[model samples]
Target: MPAEGARAGAATRGTQPAEGGPERPTRRFPRITRDTARPEGGGRAASGAAPAPARQWPLLVVLGTVALGLLLTSLDQFRPGTLLIGVALLAGAGLRWLLPGVGMLAVRSRFTDISTYGVLGLAIVLLAMMAQPNPWLQIPFLKDLLHVTLSNK
Candidate 1:
C-alpha cells in the first residue's frame, strides 16, 4: 500500500511512471493562483483614505468628459461633441504619460496606453474636422479612393 502511494505521488509530481506502459505526459497547465500582481503604475491615484472616486480621479474625469461629449451629440451638436470627445482621449493619453500612478487608468503598460489614446484621439479629431456640411478640412484623394472602391461603373 505504501509503495503504491509513493509511486502515485511520484507520477503526479514528476515524469516517473507508476506502472509504466510508456511514460505518461505531465500536466500541460500549472495550477491556477488566486490573484495576479497589480499592473505597474496602477497604484492608488490619491494616497490615504480619499475614497474610491478621488483615488481614480483621472479615469473619472476622462469618462465624465466623454459622457458630456455624448450628451452634446444627442442634443444635435455633432461637430463640437466629437471634437470634445477626441480632446478627452488626448487628455487621457497625456495623463497616462505624465503621472506615475493612475489607479485603474493604467490598464496596460504606459506606452500602450499612450499610443492607444493618441491614435484614437487623433483619428476622431480628424474625422470631426472632415464631417459633412461645410467640412473644415478636406482630402481630395479620399473622394477618389472611395469612388474607385465603391463605384459600380
Candidate 2:
C-alpha cells in the first residue's frame, strides 16, 4: 500500500500528457502582454482615447422651440388648441425615435419608452376610476391597518 501511494505521488508530479501533440498556450492574465512600455502620446493611446462630448445646444434649441410653439398653441384652451398639443407631442415622439443619441437628449430618452407605458397605465386607471361612481380614497387609519396586516402576513 505504501509502494502504491509512492508510485501515485510520483505519477502526479510530472506534467500529464495533453490530449493533442502539444498543449495550447494560455496566459493567467489574458489581457497582459510582455510590452509594458507606454506607447507614444501623453497617456492618451489609441485604445484609451476618450469619446467626444455630445453637443446639446442644438437639441436644447429644438426642444425649446417645440415647447414655445406648444405653449402658444395651448394658450387658446379651445378644441383646436388641445388637438395642437396632441400633434406636438406626437411630433416630439417621432423626432426622438428618428434621432437617438442627438446631444445629451439621449439621457432623457431612456425613460421615454417607460413613460409611454406609464401614461397608458395612468389613462387606463383614470378611465376605470371614472367608470366607477365613487373612487376609493383610503383614510390614514385604513392604510395603516392594511400595511400592518400585509406586514404580518
Candidate 3:
C-alpha cells in the first residue's frame, strides 16, 4: 500500500516515473529561459522607429476652445461662451471624424465618439439659444420636438 501510494503521488506531481516504468519528461508548469543580448545595431528595432510623441493637436484645439469658452462665461459673457462651447464640441467631433488615427482622441469607438460629441454640442447650442430672453437661432421643429419629448407622462 505504501509503495502504491508513493507511485500515485509521483505520477500526480509529474516528478518521477512509476517504480517499474520508463522515465518520463517532467511536466513543468512554467518554463524559464535566459534573456539573449539584442542584435548589434542598436536597442531600437531594425524597422523605422515610430515618432516619439503622439500627434494630438486636434485634441488640444478642442480642449483649448472649451477652456476659452469657460473663461468667457466666467467673465459674464454667458451667451457667447455657451455658443463657443457648443462649437468646440462640434469641432472636436469633426476632428475625430476627419483624423480617426489621432492619438488619445480615439478613446471610444468611432461611432460612439462622433455621436457623443455631436449630441452634446447640439443640446448645449439649443439650450443656450432657448434660454435667452430673446432667443437667437430659432428652429420651429425644435419646439415641437421638445414638446413631444418632454410631454411624455
lDDT (CA) for every model shown?
Answer: 0.89, 0.44, 0.73
Query: What ranges in model 1 sit over 4 Å off?
Result: 1-31
Q: List the residue pairs that clash in candidate 2.
A: none
Best by TM-score: 1
In the order shown, the candidates' Cα RMSDs to the true structure are 4.4, 14.9, 10.5
Kindly report which residue stretches of model 2 are placed more than 4 angstroms away from their true locations once superposed. 1-54, 73-77, 108-111, 114-153
Candidate 3, 1-153: lDDT as tens digits: 998898878776767776777656665663555674432221221123555332455667788899999999999989889989999999978876775354555566777888899999988988887776788878789778889999957
Each model's TM-score?
0.79, 0.29, 0.56
Q: Encode model 2's per-residue lDDT on 1-153: one tens digit a residue.
A: 997677555444433334344443443343446865432221211122434432454345446654665676568533333344444444444444555444433334335633563455354434333332354332468558868989946
Poorest 10 consecutive residues of model 2 by lDDT? 39-48
Ranking 1 against 3 by lDDT, winner: 1
- Backbone clash numbers for all candidates listed: 0, 0, 0
lDDT of 2: 0.44
